[model samples]
Target: MTAGIGHPMETQGSGAPGAGGGAIGLDELDLSIVHALQIQPRAPWTLVGSVLEIDPVTAARRWARLRDVGAAWVDGYLSPAQEDMTWAQLEIAVNGARLMDVVRTLCDDAGVLSLKQTSGSRDLVALVQARDVDTLAEYVSERVCRVPGVQGARVHVITATPFEGSQWRLRSLDAGQRERLRQFDETRPAPGTPVTAEPLRPVERRIAVALGTDGRMPLAALAREVDASVATTRRALGRLLNSGRLALRCNLARPLTGWPVSAMYFASVPAEHLDATATALRTLPELRFCTMTAGPHNLFLDVWLRTLHDVHALEAHISRELGHLRLRVEERAVILRTFKHVGRVLDRHGHSVRSVPINTWK
Candidate 1:
């Protein structure tokens, strides 16, 4: 959940170190810890230690070190599927010289959840969310388009996201270890849950925001964040989670993983075939996020590959396999850098360093 919008896939391809700062390499233990969280973001250290063959205290200390350096973290998302809201992706062309300045300013807004510099006709791509269609339209017109360095923007409103970031995982752990942590899997809303209308409860919204900062925060700390009693906080949290009002997932610095390359593809599919195509696309392990969007291109796909060459290889496989729909890829581009992801400000290498509170619920 880029604070406000739909969840973009968090895949970075393998490559050399990035510029802007030195890279922090992760050893076998760090990778194992990340894989543990990918399976269950809220798992207890004892469980993780048992799975990885380490003392619980040592496991906690190593994770803390990774968290401190922005190498890994867990965050919360407000489910777009369950919430009545507008989700859109923005392609903004900015004044070249002031690109960094413009991104810094936009990062302060909760509505712009994910921002990326790309290698294509558009300089920036953003995932945005708002309370309703009118609010989204107004914000794009008055707030986003009018930003000092913005030249123009094209909006692609998201219709349905069948697959997203939280579903992706690291493959470091063996099957035996993964099965041990699989018992805690309850990350998504149960099927057929009703959509929630606007105007979330005050304390519930506060709890969601606090999770965006630290997904593993204790119940007592959450109560403090919202100034409510621990029992009250626990009850609200249970309701939010059980009802699918809130979403949580573990995230790590993508660049540090073996896959560091990121790419985006925009394509068109017949309205009737959209659902079938997305269902077929979900099985692709490289898929980061896939959505049926309301725009010239009905399909938007983001993925990470092992190498830059794999970009075209995956695209070719899609066109060849789904040719019955005459699915044409209108445009494709790779990400140059990500300035902000969801609510976290990232370094060029995609590590979270600072967080701007996600204010979408307000």
Candidate 2:
């Protein structure tokens, strides 16, 4: 049971680590550097240089800056079933005084991938990836539960995830706006209207691929892959990120960490009352994901349960809280396998980052 005091707010940022050194603010060059790296983390400097049309040394230095800020990183995503592993998310409630201490231990766990200190009923949320279901149970039942002053720890096994990550869609930004993007290097601007339904181009697609692979490639290296100049590549990335098209961050699946149960809760609310109902569900401590979709059921909540009992309790709690509205439970389909992610089909899309393949770099 997650026990906390404050209401949960809708706030999310890139989960990937940022450059730790506060040497200087970001600029267009840094963004370009990130864009190129995400597509091809291991790409050669010579190839990247060609993409940015700059020499190798310049590209390397820019990449170093991005890394220093913890803005981006690259790592392999080992499949859970194939790798003989199990994963889950741990939602914990702790006294405010011991929050940091608990978080420190949680972060130190070898199995833990990502940890977030959040508001609402739970003080800390963690994504744990382990070798097997047994490992997941031990990590939560023994290691995490042993923390001092811990009220409770909830673990949820992730059966399947239809979508995750920051949802980086670079389909917005026209050529001109993209050109202007090279001027600013920050990850995102203040909140604005969502940008969808726009067309994407070749360079943008390549940049997205590059960032998908590395998120921290040197400008020269990135340029070589896309066959563009460092100046041009940097501008394109800046535009993509600042405009919220491409997100450069680490996406560690919760299953990788150990909490594995995946369930969706549907609440029936009348049209006029939808807003309030959604607001209430958002405040729920166990609800990690919520959405207002187009269907007979307007409100949907995605939750990860630590144990079988918690699963029943979660549903019961929702029913008790919103029973007046006639809530419904729609079980989410288990993820037997994941063939594609972030637009990259592991088997098919891995080879080509662009819609049309061009051998210009070679």
Candidate 3:
């Protein structure tokens, strides 16, 4: 296995690390830990160990390694449909010299969740959520297009996300396999105290991978596939569900349903008043997301709307809220295709055998 290939992937960080910073190397154990967590982030070490048949000490060591390396993190993801909202992806065309500035501004806004600098016709890609079309337009025209350095922008409203996050079940690392991955643990510490009494083994990983691929499989089928009893399979799956690591939801595309106008806009706001300004921006019904960030301009926001009139209303409201903030509308762009979504796993190398109890947050 290559470096960094076996682990659960991390979000691309800022070019520079924060105060205490460094890069993490991937090993076989890290891969196994990641694969198990991917199945259920909240799983207890005891259960994981039991499932894998390893003592708690080894499992704890593996889990700690993954955390230290930043291979995995727990985060929340809510379905837009659950809240009666819509999701969209935006592409912004900006002056190359000011690309970083543009991205920073968008990050500070709350509505904007994730941003990336890309190597295509567009310089930045953003994700935004909104309640309706009018608010989305207001977000674009009044807040985004007017940003000082922006040239243009486009929006591709997300229709559905069939699959997202679930990387652990895809990994295949046993005690022996993990040893092989330790290419150079020169100063690695001697194994320490137990962090938990359970961890997933190779067989458990096999069960997880099966579920990750298809959450709707019948219990009998899953038991047969994983070579476990029906009762055991049910228990394991229940633990995974309670863990917050595995989630299943409906995926739908908006374009196929009739709402097809994907719009983009820009805005320029001042740094000091960015928070207040973004707060006002969110009051509109159309906006799904917004934020403030480090950039030439103070704030960046994105929204998705369906009609021209609604867009006009949202823009007018944003302008009125800014009063004399001297914000300018910049650029907007749309998306035509998606290579991947949130939860799709990037690597598929290993499996686990044991079952573990999961730790879930309320």
Candidate 4:
């Protein structure tokens, strides 16, 4: 999950409401709409309207406004198949003079999933993905380590991802609204199942590319883009989604939600207790990302909190509850700014301004 560190009302252009400003205030209805999508990203506008007690057209219009201003967006990408994919985190200590340049170059690389300028011993922290362990090793040893900044790097290969961004929710809606949205939700595949590494057909690739830009695109529009009949397109989409190959996510500007602080923790946990520890961590509402990695620090967590002070409270709580897990905290870093999140290019305020589709095969 990505969070911004900007003020709620900050803006760049005219001060007019809904204009291109640094911050956009969201009303109760707007928040409900976002929450509805968060629960079921591709839910029909009519269904969303019913859940939020608004007209279907009004619901669509409101979402259009948010999407046009870059306050919210929906993205679809190929999910990592356990048998064929690998995820890793990199901590790079770059030369001071070339930090910005190096960051820009890494952000433009398709393999780098998220890049952030952080406050800690390291200058930058990156989440990257590869086809396999060997590919990840070569990418780190050759491509990333050989960057012009001329700095040493530390790599942590993720071995098991117990929880990730897709499982995160804004939790702003009421219980009734959430229950209404859940009817359209799809069940996520269990971890460790081997998904067939099938190559996408040309038409399927085209559809995926289109959805990458707007996961909530209308079915008719998607069919037109792929030059296929609506029924055929819908069937293909269902197959892709059910095949455990594609994932849809609804992302919103962090400033709008009032939870702006983002923090990452690196710690070590015994192998035997990793599963229980990870499962417990996933129960926290603030937990955004959690994984077991192959490194000195075996566990990593990314969380979003209401304020910086809450970080201490959270750490203390974790220590008290799961102390028996023998989690050894190694390093902690606050994400000062995020340049890219998932597959979308974000602005300083964490709004998705543009999308650079993540095609792992490319």
- The models' CA-based lDDT, in order, is 0.80, 0.49, 0.46, 0.77
Measured against the true structure, the TM-scores of the candidates, in listed sequence, are 0.89, 0.45, 0.43, 0.86
Model 1 per-residue lDDT tens digits across residues 83-140: 4568898999999998988998888888887899999899999998888888989989
Better of 1 and 4 by TM-score: 1
User: Which is superior by lDDT, 3 or 4?
Assistant: 4
Q: Candidate 1, which ten residues in sequence have the lowest lDDT sum?
A: 1-10
Clashes of each: 9, 59, 83, 4
Q: In model 3, how large is the Cα lDDT of residue 99?
A: 64
User: What TM-score does structure 3 among the candidates reach?
Assistant: 0.43
- For every candidate in turn, the CA RMSD to the true structure comes to 5.2, 16.1, 20.4, 5.3
Lowest lDDT 10-mer window, candidate 2? 353-362
**Model 4 poorest ten-residue lDDT run:** 8-17
1 versus 3: better TM-score goes to: 1
Off by over 4 Å in 4: 1-19, 80-82, 185-206, 224-232
lDDT digits (tens) for residues 169-277 of candidate 3: 3324455534433332212233552222244444444555565333335668878988998877766655444333234421112221122233344566665665566
Q: Could you tell which candidate, 1 or 2, scores higher by lDDT?
A: 1
lDDT of 4 by residue, 20-139 (tens): 664466776776787788778899888998888889999999899888888888988766434346888888889999987887788777788788888989888888888788888888
- Per-residue lDDT of model 2, residues 1-362, tens digit only: 22312221112112322323223343444444444544443455565566666788887777654443433344223222222245565667887788767755654454554455543455665655665677678768787888886778877665432233332211222354334433334333336735443544567668765554455566788888888988777666655654444544432222321233444544456766666665566545445555454444455465544444566677777767766665666443222222223323221111111111111111
